[model samples]
Target: MEKPNLFSIATKELSQDAFITWLLQWADDKYKKENEHLCLLGKEFAKSLIKLDKKLNAENIKIAKVTAGRQWKNIDIWAEINDDYALIIEDKTQTGQHDEQLKRYKKIAENYYKGERKVICIYIKTGNECNSSLQYIQDNGWYIFSRSNFLAALKAFNTKNNIVEDFTSYLDNIEKETNSYQSKDKLKTWLAAQGFYLWLEKQVTDWNEWNYVANPSGGFLGFWYYFTACKKTKGAEIYIQLENRFDSGIDLCIKIGADWERTTEHLYKVYGILFEEAKKFNIEITKPKRFKAGAYSTVALVKNAFTTTSDEKLDLEKFLTVLTNTENLVAEAALKC
Candidate 1:
């Protein structure tokens, strides 16, 4: 049997406070190998200090103390180095730093240390949304440790302990998936996935035959690629809209837009052809809307093209297949137009 990684499991199951406490334990000198007075974590973290501000001295690396959550109004982390320097870290996992949060922590650290140490605040974030706090952090001369860099630092000074190694790998995987737009559980991640999808659209779609357009705003639920004016018939336009909805399964709406003309015949032909094409691939089409709002256009909704969940969970590999399939259908129908 494989060794189970409890540290990885705890990070997901345990509360933020507990996880922070665990990190605090590792940051202290007591966690280091026997007889090592030097704080291994403080030493590694101090390296980050030099990277953030070259003015800070990196030599004579001895962390006097490492503490967290006991004093100074629950400031996430506090480290005193060589009895004269302090590093205050505010670590965030799911949330971004609030306005003046880091600033407030800096003041608290300074007051607690009481002119005994030079202090600097560092914001350590795992999430990708921090645009709002960037200027504030910059103005306050605070440093930021993004997910990627933080993981890199952890990997560099690993203690060769199995638990620590597993935890590091867990964080590494999370950063990779989140940064690459592979996880769409959050709104920001979903938008990133859409941005990547738009890039794929530009690469695969022919501008002369298809005109690609994104949602007017990121707040919108969906966007589409439609046939150009030249390729569109007076009564119908071939298009595919990829929709993201919280209460509905993944939808790839293959629609035929039409004017006020008699388009029932065109609608029948297109719907039949689309239904047959979808059947060939075991994709069941539903929610047939023929002549919506008195317009001659028709819509055939294909559900579960990527996922069965109603949430904005995107499966990129399956989505690419759906996009290609929809594009082929639209292209085939365009030849008739």
Candidate 2:
């Protein structure tokens, strides 16, 4: 049996911030003699941050102090290193930056330093997030330190400390669980759905956005791509949406532009075009039972959209072919509209 992991119980962002802060504290010179392994790990982490800034070098630098929590304008982790660099880490676990917090935090750090100390901002996420979200973080000028990156760093330093071992084991378990969709016969958990969506984002092209779609009953992971302008209706567009509800089956939906009368009219015309085009690829797309007009209403749906293997697992290669065909079909139909 495996040992009990405290991280499993305390799965909050605050707990994760505390662990990281504790690890960074070992970088102080006072702990070098007592716990060299942890000290080296801490120093390595600091060096990783320093490496992000081209102007600063990690060699011969010592960590002066490390602070966590509400001390430095609510930044998750702040490390003052040797009168040259101040490292600001915004740690996240299963949540994303909101309300322009990344920008706000970066401005606060710069203001605090006032150009005296060079501020290096790092956004460390030890949880599953879509590629789009990660790109947004990068767009805001914060370097991303992802779960895989952190794991690689930890795996490099083999340690026997209980705290390190437990934390590492817990993280390893979480990674496995998040990636479980690849091995499972059926997708059942939200993590698995997220993993599937993230994988799809990497494979698919021309997608504008993807995220969770919340409903009163429950929510599902959704992806939108293949946006084509409607020649028939001005300021209107058509797009494809992939909605994965795990056990409920994947849905391939065609969303038409806003305006009830025009949308309703174009729905039938596009449906006819897509239905015939889909048939060429041995796929079937059906018009929705009832038509509801709105801003981007679902006009057609392909139920059980994913192609499965002989053993009933998701056949990713076959699914990719289906998606490619769908894109072509939609594009061809849009040309006629």
Which candidate number would show the highest TM-score if scored against the true structure? 2
- Per-residue lDDT tens digits for candidate 2, residues 287-322, read 877776677677788755676777767778877877
- Model 2 is weakest, by summed lDDT over 10 consecutive residues, at 62-71
Q: Model 1, which residues run further than 4 Å from truth?
A: 1-42, 49-51, 59-71, 182-337
TM-score, model 1 to reference:
0.50
Q: Write the per-residue lDDT of candidate 1 for residues 240-316, one digit (tens) a residue.
A: 76555523433567765544234566666666667776655646777564445334244577766665235455566
Candidate 2 deviant stretches above 4 angstroms: 59-71, 184-186, 258-266
Clashing pairs in 2: none
Which 10-residue window of candidate 1 scores lowest in summed lDDT? 208-217
State in Å the error of residue 330, model 2. 1.0
Native-referenced Cα lDDT, model 1: 0.57
The lDDT values for all models are 0.57, 0.76
